[model samples]
Target: MKLIISYKLDSIENVIPEKQIEIIKLFSYSKSDFIVRKIIEACNLKHPNLEKIPAYNILKNNLNEIINNCLDSIAEKRLVNNQFDMAIIEVVIIDNGHTLIMKLKDNGIGLGENYLHKLSYPEFKHTKSQEHFKKKEKDYCIGGCGIGLFHLNAKLAKNDAKLYLKSRKEAGATIEISMKKPY
Candidate 1:
């Protein structure tokens, strides 16, 4: 069986580069630590102010949305191909409490160097994911509004927090979120 995922990407294609830089810069100045439960909790909050203002407070209100949204996209695409699997979204603290890193992984479609071209530095904007879903493609999906990641990138756009992504063509994809120093 063959699968085709089709959608217009011109609008978002320009966002990758600018978004990448902003996200990394935001992470540069950290001083925040997010517990797994908070990550889960913040996902439910509709507001962008995920964390209350205070020193040493880890703010990641929309993390779950970002990860879950990505998963939803993955699942949608899989459905088109009649494939199924759980996309594990994990937040791992790599260094001491001073540094934070998150990993959103999926055993779905792996991103290649070619896919890298689509990345852009994120910015605050209104985006719609439904566009990526094309009726002509069964194994394809229109991801959530780009705002999820863009907000994440902008929110983390301090002190060099970096968002990295890796994809293995037929394997899947993994997104790494890391910040250099915490407040």
Candidate 2:
């Protein structure tokens, strides 16, 4: 699947401070299950027939995991002061007759070089350092067992989809998933 148009994360000036705070609060304070429900609801509203699509369960799970990972990254950056005052997560979906593409961009502490290497394999668990895990902060930012991307990649493959990841150490990350439409 060729990505024709790439949308970057919104510029700092374009992000509203109030909305940013609201998003941070929501992610930082709210339960992840609650957040997932909200995300699924939004997706359902946008694609009412999503449940009828082939590999619907896989698609839905992929979307939720990807979004949760993005949110967790943003929350971590906020904790480490690596994120800007206004954080942003931009999700774009496009259906161009033959393929369905979903791209998620976030202004968070991007993946480091070490983490990038582990991301290549589905079996390898990508985890943060001991210090990060020791932090006694909000549960939302703590993230999972470092298997989300691995699972995401495996699931995408099941649906004949591909996952592309691009990131800069301190800048941000962009994840794109594309699969052929089942006609």
Candidate 3:
């Protein structure tokens, strides 16, 4: 009887872990797309770093999108062409049948105190609060409605997914997006 019980317990443990679904961790902004690439290969024993983005955005296109997102929080924190700083983006992947998870993180001026609740609506204008959202005056920002996060939330819900974001003013922010397999 004890042997049977032990076997049952073992099977239960395995089943629970197996149902974990997916997990992704992103580290920085400069590594935004890079981290996305990393999630694609997280299952491998050795992961290769590939920045194989199409020539359309020229890598600059992606960064521009991120910069635009940042402005919603900072409003006046865009980096100048000469002011060099990389954003942190990390991704962790867990294979759970029809599910995939992606987490993106950045250590830049995060959403302000009032921005947490607004993350579901994570877009704000620099002029809206007399704050600096973009990097600097010289930095060209990407295009966005400042309502990008809303779209993200909608998509996640469609897949019965979860999106988590943590942020603080002048500190940094983290975002986690999980889906039931979006390829």
Candidate 1 per-residue lDDT over residues 22-126, each given as its tens digit? 442332222012223445444334323323322113235455465455455565456645554443444443434455455666565454456443444444343
For 91-121, candidate 3 gives per-residue lDDT tens digits of 3444455544444555445656675565464
Each prediction's RMSD to truth: 15.3, 6.1, 15.7
Off by over 4 Å in 3: 1-35, 43-87, 94-100, 121-128, 133-145, 181-183
CA lDDT, candidate 3, residue 92: 42
- When sorted by TM-score, best at the front, the candidate numbers are 2, 1, 3
lDDT of each: 0.46, 0.64, 0.41
Instruction: Give residue 107's lDDT in candidate 2 (0 to 100).
Output: 75
- The candidate with the higher lDDT, 2 or 3, is 2
Question: Please, what are the lDDT tens digits per residue for candidate 2 over residues 46-132?
Answer: 667666666556767666667667666766676676444555677667777777677778776777666765766746855576666
Clashes of each: 34, 0, 32
- Estimate the TM-score of every prediction: 0.51, 0.68, 0.47
- The list of candidate 1 runs beyond 4 A from truth reads 1-59, 96-98, 110-112, 121-142, 145-147
What C-alpha lDDT, on a 0 to 100 scale, does residue 168 get in candidate 2? 76
